[model samples]
Target: MADQDFDVVVVGSGAGALLGAIRAQEQGLKTLLVEKADLFGGTSALSGGGIWIPANYDQARAGVRDDLRTAFGYMLRCVRGMASEDRVLAYVETANTMAEYLRSIGVPYRCMPKYADYYPHIEGSMPGGRTMDPVDFNAARLGVDALETMRACPPGSKLFGRISINAFQAHSMLSREFKSRFQLIGMMLGYFLDYPWRRKTQRDRRLTGGQALIAGLLTAARKAGVQMWRNAPLRELVQDASGRVTGVVVEKDGRQLQIRARKGVLLGAGGFERNQAMREQYLTQPSRAEWTATPVGGNTGDAHRAGQAVGAQLHLMDWSWGAPTMDVPKEPAFRAIFVERSLPGCMVVNSRGERFLNESGPYPEFQQAMLADHARGNGSVPAWIVFDAGFRAQNPMGPLMPGSAVPDSKLRKSWLGKVYWKGETLDELAAQIGVDAAGLKDSARRMTEYARTGKDLDFDRGGNVFDRYYGDPRLKNPNLGPIEKGPFYAMQLWPGEIGTKGGLLTDRDARVLDTHGQVIPGLYCVGNNSASVMGPAYAGAGSTLGPAMTFAFRAVSDMLGRPLPLQHADWLEQPERAAQRPAERMAQAA
Candidate 1:
C-alpha cells in the first residue's frame, strides 16, 4: 500500500470527529477526517444536539447561574460511584471551557428551556444549565456542494414534509392554546417554502438541532482548512515497531491505503449498534438490528474492534444510550420514541401483562427496567407498549401519525407475529398481544382507578416534571390517564439504544488505555468509541454529546500541549449567584 501522510488522522465524522480535526488543524497539524458512509455526519446529525456543559457562559449571560461544585455533586450522585471521580471532575472542570472554545471557533450555543435533569432530586442535578443546545445554523452558509453533503434528519423526525423541530417546540405543540398552534404553523410555513425549492437545488437552507450541530462544525472545519473524505472506512490501525499507533489503513475506492499520522490517530467513530453479532455478544438483552435507531451499517464498531484487537482496555461493555424505538419501514433509522411513552393513557408491560415501569421515565431508565425484567427469568424480550383508542385519537403514537388509522398490513400476522397489534376488547387484545387475559384485565382496572384518584399506586407515573414534560398539559393528571377505551393498541419493544456507550477505555487526557492500564502512546478516542465519563447514568440532556465533545477538546488540548481554559467567569464562584437555582432556569428559558 502507498503511504498517505498527515500529522493527525481522525476516524469518524460525528461531533467528536469534526471537532478534533478542526482543533488539530488549528494547531497547524495536517489533520483529516475519514468517514465510512457516503454522508459526512453520523448519529450526531440525527440527535437532539444538546451538549450538557456544566457551567456554560450561555447560562451566565442569561442570568441563569450554575457552578462547578454543584454540577460535580449532581454527577457524583447520579453515577452512584460507577464512574471515575477524577474523570468526572475533569469533565465538570473542563465542560464550560469547551463551550467557550467552540464559540471561539464559530459554533454558538443557547441554553435549552425547562430541560430538567433526568433525576432532578439528585444532589448536583439542576432543572437547567446542565445542558446547552447549538444555535440554529443556516445551511446556506456551507455553500451548495457542502450543503448537499450534509446528512438530513431521519425519517420519523420531520413533520408535514421537509420540516424539523426542537424539543421545546415538540413539547409546546402538545398544548391547546392558539399560541402554540400558531407557532407550529409559522414554523411549518418556513419548511413549506423550502419543500419545493429543495426539489430543484442542492441547498436545503434551513438546519436545526443535530443538522445544525454537524453543519456548523463542518463549516468551522472547512474554514480552518481541515480535509475530510467520505466512503473511506478505516480498515485497521497502523502502528510502529515500538507499538505506538502511527496511522491507519483505510479501504477507499476498493483499495487499502496506509495513511501515516506523525502525532496520533483520534478514534471518534461511533458504536456497534447495528452489528447483530456484537449486539448478542456484548449487550445483555439486545434488540434486533432491524428495530434499532442507529443508521444502517453506520456504527458497526470498526474503530472499537481495531482498538480491541490492539489490546485497548474495554470497560462498560454492557451499557448504551438506550431508547425504546419501533420499526417504520419508510423511516431509514428507528421510529422515534421521544413523546409517545409520556403521553397520557400509555403503559408498558412484560409478557405476563403486568406493568413493569414508569413509562414516562427517561429511555435509559426504561431500558434498565426492561433488562431487569428479562433477568427475572421470565421471557420479557418483547415487552408490549400499549395504549387505548382515545389515546391514539388524542396523540401520535410512534410513527403512526396522529388521526391516522393503523395500517392494515401491520395488523396481519407473520412469522414475527404482528409488530403492531390492535383489538376491540381487553381479552381479544390480550390474545392478540400474547398475554394473559386476566392479568391484562387486572392491570387495566387498576390504572383506571388510579387515573380518577390522580395517583399511580404501582409506579407513580406522573410524579415528576420530566414525566410531565411530554404530557398533554390540559389533562388533570397529565401522564396518568386510563387505557379504558375500546380499540386498544400495542407495539412490541425490545432492548434498543440511541447508540452503544461501551468502547475503548481512555484516561483523563482521552488517551486510549491498554488492557494492562498503560497508555497507547499515539492513540486517543472520543465520542462513543471511548468509555463514557458518565458510566451507567445519563445525568442530563446531551450527557453523551457533552462528554464526547469535551474529551475531544481535551484530547486536542493534550495533543497540542495547551492549558485548558478556566471553566467560568470569576464572579460565578459566589454561592448565591452560582447556577440558575431551582425553578429559575425554567423562567429564564421562558
Candidate 2:
C-alpha cells in the first residue's frame, strides 16, 4: 500500500488515547487520533472525573506527605495479590510526573485531601491526599468551533468537587433544623445554571472535562503537528510478512482506507461493558443488558477483539471493577448504588431475604458481596437495599435517575419496585421482602439489642473508622439502630459499573504484550481498554481516571523514548515541612 502517513495512530479517544496523542505530538512525531464514535471523550467524559494519584506533588503542597514506598505498599494491599509488584511500583512512582505533565499542558487539578482508599483499614493505606480530581472547567472556554466536537457528562448531573461518600453521608446526617437548606437550594440552582452555561458556551465553543483534557492535549498535539481523524474506525491491523503489525485498515465515510504506521498503534478504545454479548458472558447478570453508565453508544470492545486477533494476551477478562446499581424502568441504563441516606442502620439483603452486608461500605465491596451472594444461590437477579422510614428522611440517595438532575422523590410513586413497605412489626417487613421472615426478624431483633447498647456485635458494621465515616455521630447508635418502626423501605438494586476494569494486558510502559511477555510491535493500550493498574479492586475517589491518565502519560513518554522527570522530589523531601514553611505561606498570601 502507499505510505498513508502519520508516525503514530492512536485508537479510541478516552484519557489514554488523548494522552498518547499529546505525548506523540510533544515528541514532534506526526500523530493521528481516530475515534469510532461521533464525539470524543468516551467513558472518561461520563465519569466522576477523579484521578487517584497517591504521593503526588499536589498533596505535598497541600500539607500531605506520601512517599513512593508508602504509596507502593498501599497499592499492593489495595489490589490484594492481583497486580504485579513492578506494575504497581511503576504506576505509583510515575503518578506525580503524570499529574505534573497534565498541569503543564493546562489541565487544572485539585487534591482530594480527605479521600481514603476503599479499604482504609488495610495496611499501608493513606488516610488522605491519595487522589486528585480535575477542577470543573467551563465548557465554553474551549471556544465555539470546538463545541460540537466535544461531549459532556450525561445531562442533568453535576459532580461535586472532591466529594466522598462519607462526606455526603455526613451532610445527610444533619437534623432538619441544622441543615443548610439554602445551601442545598443554591447547589441545585448552581447545577441548573451551570448546565446552561456549559451548553450556551459550547454553542459558540465546547469545553468540558473530557473535552478540556482532550482539547488541551489536542492543542499540544496540533502545535507539535499531530494529525487526528474523527469518525474513523480501525477495520483491522495489517501485518508484514514477518508477522509484525505495520498498518491498519480504517473505514470512514463509506470508504475503506489503509494507513501504514512505521512505529506503533495504540488501542485505547475502552472496554466492553456496554457490549451485551460480553456483558452477559462475563458478568452473567441480567442487569448487564440494561447498564447505561458506559460511553452511551459505542464502546463495544473493539480494541480487545482487534488486539486478540493479533495474538495479544489478555488478563482479568473474567473480572470487573464491580459496581452496585439500580435498574430503571424507562431505559436499561443502571445507576450506581445510591447508598440510601438511611443506611446507618439499614442492611443490604439478597433475594433470599438474608442480610448480606453493611450497606455503608464502599461500592466495590458492596458489589463483590452481592455477586458472592448470587453465587451462593441467593439469586443476584433481585437484591434489595433495605432500610426504614427514619433512614429515608435523612440521607440523599443521589439523583432520581442515573443522568437526571432531580432528587429522588420521598414517595414510592417516583421510585422503582416497592421502595416503601410497612408492617406493624419486623416480621411483616421480612415477609414482604420474601426473605426468611424469622431470620430477618431475628437479625433485626439482635441488631436492635446491639443498637440499644450502642454496638453491632454481629457484623461490627460501624465499629471501624471507615464505617463511622458514614455514620451519624449524633445518633445514640451509629450503626445498629433498630428497624422496629411501622413502615420499612426496600429499594431494588442491580450490579452497576462505572466501567469494566479488564482489558489488554500491558507492561509499565503501557505497551500491549503477548502471553510470552513479548511486546506486540506497533500495539499499545491504555485507560479502560487495558487491565486496570488497581487490578480487581478499586480505591477511593478518582481510582479509574487516575491510572487511566497516568498510564496515558507514561505511554506517551514511552512512545517518545523519554523519561518523565521526577521533579517533585525536591518538593517531596520533607513535604510537610516545605508546606508549612513561612516562605510558602507568604507565597500563597502574595
Candidate 3:
C-alpha cells in the first residue's frame, strides 16, 4: 500500500458509510472511514434508529408472507411517483438479503412488529413487521470508541419502556375510577423521576436513536480493525484520466491530504440539511434554522458537491424525511416533538388557528401541510399543537424547557412544566393562543362526542392498522378523545427532520450512476446520501437505517463478487441471542 491508500475510502461515518466500510473490509479490502466531525457518527446518530425493511429475514421467520412484488407495489403506491421505479424495486428486492447479511455480521436487530409504513391506508401497505430497531446495547461496551462517536437514543432521550403519549392518554381514559387515579399518580412519579434524570444526564451525555445505531456500528467497526479518521472532510474525488475514482483530497487537521482508494470510494456523508442556501432554494421556506438536530457544521454538502463534480446523477434534490420540531427560542438546537405525531387526541393548528391535517398522520403529510401553510404566508413560524387538560395529565411530555430556553420572554413567563398554557377556561386558552375561540370550542365538542361513540367522523384517524398500532387499545375511542377541558395546553411545534434524503443516484447494486445514467466506476452511495428507496414518504421506525445498511451490504457484495459467510447462523437467527452477544465478538475476524 502507498503512504495513504486503501481498497475503499468512505466519506462520512453515517450508518451507510459504516456498513459499506465493514462490507469492504470483509471482502479483503483495506477500507478507510473519514468523517467531518470530531465524532464518528453523522446525522444517523441523531435519528430514530429505525430501518424499514419489508419482508425482512426476521419477518419471514415469523411467518409473515411479504413478497418482493407486494413490497414494491406498496412502495410505488405509497410514494406515488416520488420515488423512481428502479430505485424502489432495488430496495424491495434486496432488503431481505441486506437484513440477513447484517444479522450474520452481528448487528443486533429487532422487528418492530406493530409499526407500519407512513401511509398504511394506501394500497399495498403491510400490517406489521416492516421496520426494525437496534436492540439496546450497553454503551460501556464500546470502550474508547464510544467516547469518539455519538450514540443514538442518547442518555437524554431514553424513557424506561414508556409508551407514546396518546397511548398513555387512552389508557387513562379507559381505566376504572380507582385505577385511573392510581395510574395517574404512578405516571406523575415516573415523569418527575425521568425529568430530573434526563436534565442531569443531558448535561453530561445525550442518548437517542442515532446514538444507539452509531455505538453498535462503531463497536463492530472497531472490532473489525477498520480505521476511522475523524474531522477529515473529503474535499474532492481524485480520479485518473481513465475516469476512474482513485482517491480523495481531504482536509484533515487544516492540511490537504490525498488518500487513495484502490477498490472503490463510497459517498455516505449525509444530506444538505444545514445548507441554508439549499434549504431556502429547495425547501422554499425562509427559515432553515429548524431543519435538523445533528451538528449543523457538517452541512457543507461535501458529498453532494464532490459527487456532482464527478458527474454523479442527483435525484430527489427537493425532498426530505420530514419531522415536526419546537424552536427552543435561545437554545442552539430545536426540540423534536414526538408527541404531536405519536400522541392521539391532539390537533395541530397553523397561525390562523384552524386544523391543518391529521396530527398523527405520516410526517411527510404533516410537512406538506406545513409547507402549504408557509406558501399561504406562514413561513415556518409558530405552529401550536393543542390538547386538553385530559391530555396534559395522561400523556407524558419528555422534556421541559426552562424560561431560559424560550426565545420570547413573554412566552417563557407562561411555562408550567413541559407545557405552555394560558387559560382559566377553554375559551380563555383559545383566545390566549390566538385561535378562534368559538371554532376551537366547537371542534373540541365534536371530537369529544365522537370519542363517546368510538369513531372519528372527521379524519378517520383511528380506523386503520397503522393508526391503531400507535393508538392506545385501552380506550374505546382510541384516537377520538375530545379536547373540551378547561386549561388546554399548546406546545409550539416546528418543521424539523431526521436528515435530508436527496443525493447521488444509484442502481440496485448500490453503484453511483452518472447524469447520463452510466455507472461512475469505483464509486457507490448508500444511506441518506442516496435517494431514499421509499421516496418522498417515510415508512415505519427503522426504514432509514435498514436501507442504509442493506445497500452498504449490497455494495460490498458487488465489490467482493460473493456473499460473506456467518460465523454462527443459529445464534444470529434469534433476536435475543444476537443482542446479548458481546460487541467485541460481533464481527468475525476477516
Q: Which has the greatest TM-score?
A: 1
- Please write out the lDDT profile of model 3 over residues 527-562, one tens digit for every residue: 778877666677666667777877788788767766
After the best TM-score superposition of candidate 2, give how far the Cα of residue 430 lies from its true spot, in angstroms.
4.8
All-Cα superposition RMSD per candidate: 6.4, 8.8, 9.3
Q: Per-model C-alpha lDDT, please?
A: 0.79, 0.65, 0.67
Give the least accurate 10-residue stretch of model 3, judged by summed lDDT.
581-590
lDDT of 1 by residue, 1-590 (tens): 43788999999999988988998999899997999999988999989898988778888676677878888878866765445556677788988888888889877888865677888667767776667877777777786688678777875676654576766677687655557778778876776667655765633466778888899999999999998999999999988889999889998899988998888899999988888888888887545676678778699989999998788987677888887777655567766576688887878878788998998888898877888898995556778888888877777776666644444454334513445677889899899878888888888888888888888988889888778777767777788788899888888777778898988978767888887778898899998988787878889889988888889888888777673644433323233322222124224333
lDDT of 3 at 78: 60
Residue 466's lDDT within candidate 1 is: 72
**Alpha-carbon lDDT of model 3:** 0.67
Give the winner by lDDT.
1
Candidate 1: deviation at residue 252, Å?
1.7
Worst lDDT 10-window in candidate 2: 161-170
Q: Model 2, range 1-590, lDDT digits (tens) per residue?
A: 63487678888887778877887777777778888888777777656556788778788678888777777777766765455555666688887788888888777776767566667777777767776766545444455565467555544233342111223323343333346556566554655556655555422122334445555655555555667678898788887877677777888898988887777777788888878888876664554645545656777888788888887777767666666766544432566753352346567676656677776677767777777778889775467666555554555453332212333353346454444455556666667767677766666666667778887665667766556555566666555566656466666677667777788778777877776667787677887788887876776667777777777777767667674544334423333432232224234434
